[model samples]
Target: MQIISALSEVSDRYPALFVDLWGCVHDGLKPLPGAVEALQAYRAGGGVVILVTNSPRPRAGVAAQIEDIGVPDDAYDNIATSGDSARVAMFDGAVGNKVWHLGPDHDAGFFDPPAILSNPTPIERVPLDQAEGIVCTGPFDPLADPSDLRPQFLAAKTRGLKLLCANPDIVVDRGERREWCAGALAKLYTEMGGESLYFGKPHPPIYDLARRRLAAIKEVSDAGILAIGDGPVTDASGAMGENLDLLFISGGLGAVETGTAPGGDPDPTKLNAYLAQTGVSPTYVIGTLR
Candidate 1:
């Protein structure tokens, strides 16, 4: 992978960018330094920016959250979230009518019907034992270990209920604190023999939704699009699967492994080792979005 100092060095090559949010643009609690400016600058040059995120929130919810986190509206053109993709699948009966919601109250918005579906299946969130399927936005507690859900997952597995994972992220750094995501729960469920359906990064459904969102604003092909993100498993894998160029931000989740300091470049040797270990070959690597 080529280690670049800034996004401007390669921004002109793509007509559109599919950018990840949590690590590339923000640190969960606030916008990352230089990220907003870079995106805004790219847009000023007539490039389309689509915030393709694995967030469990819908597009509007993500927009509002980012706005509150200080990422302005002008930074990007549009957004496509995993929650929306999974919600569509949920309402289409990917999960049965009655589902047990396994997440915090803030993620209750996952039940909100998408406007695009004219006649969606009526869904009801019932108790775990009474439900036909499970909709996991995340753990009820982000800081708790995923193994704690084994008992519940075993019950679901015995019942043969499919799990619809809203966000396929294993974890995210909220400032300096790391927390588990829905993917971790889904992963555990699958390990215990329960089927888990993912609709986020490294999966096809969210990418399909992102393309549709991009198509509404611009008609750029996969070759004309660049994917920027920090998660090797999620972002890098997703970009590679979709045959898009990826700009991997090493300083976010892999900073320790890459020996990247804040606002500094990653050590080439360490970065290479990390990439090799993860088995992800990104087109470009940056310490941060800038």
Candidate 2:
């Protein structure tokens, strides 16, 4: 893949850009260097920037985190998260309304009142054994091992409750460490023969919704849209599935496997092989978004 120094080189080719929020724009703790500048520059050049994230929290929740982390308001045109998409699905009656909320209290925003569910069936939160389905945002504790959820998943499997995974990211970088996500738990559930539905990156619904949002801001064909992200399983695969050009940023989650040096230099051959192994070939590769 060709390595680019700045997003400016290809900014003119696409009318819209779908950028990943966590690894691409920032880590969980703070905004990454030059990320905001790159986005501002892209919008200034007339490109519609939509921050597409695997975050299980709704737009409002994600926005709060973004604000707290100091991501400037003008960096992008809009934001969309897996939680927003999952809530839409739940509202459309994709899953039973009576569900168990499985993530931390911080993620309770996904199910709490004042956050209305449009279905005729009343939206209710029940105990795990009494629920018809489950909604998992992520691990209750980011530091906990996914294996710790196996017994609970087995119980759900036996009871035959559908699982709605708000985020399809298996893991994400949180400052200097990696944290397990809802997708990881969903994987465990599936292994135990449980039925699970995921909404987020690498999933078509979120991408389709994102495309429509981008179209609303500025009309652009899928080919005229560029997807920028750092993860292969989520971003690269999702972009390819949506038929959009991809810009893969190095030094994110797979830094070690890609032979990205501590100094921020990546070994091109190793990086390409890692993508190849995942069956993803990005249109371009850059060490950073800048």
- Cand. 1 TM to true fold: 0.99
* Model 2: per-residue Cα lDDT over 176-286, one tens digit each: 888899999898899889998988999998887787777778888888889999888999999988888999887787778788653265687898788878787889887
Q: Which stretches of candidate 1 lie over 4 Å from their true place?
A: none
Query: Model 2, stretches more than 4 Å misplaced?
Result: 112-120, 261-265
Worst 10-residue lDDT window, candidate 2: 112-121
Superposition error at 169 for model 1 (Å): 0.3
Clashing pairs in 1: none
Q: Which numbered prediction scores highest in lDDT against the true structure?
A: 1
Q: Can you give the lDDT of residue 196 in candidate 2?
A: 83
**What RMSD value applies to candidate 1?**
0.6
lDDT of each residue in 258-287, candidate 1, tens digit only: 999999999999999999999889999999
lDDT against the true structure, per candidate, is 0.95, 0.84
Candidate 2 colliding pairs: none
lDDT of 2: 0.84
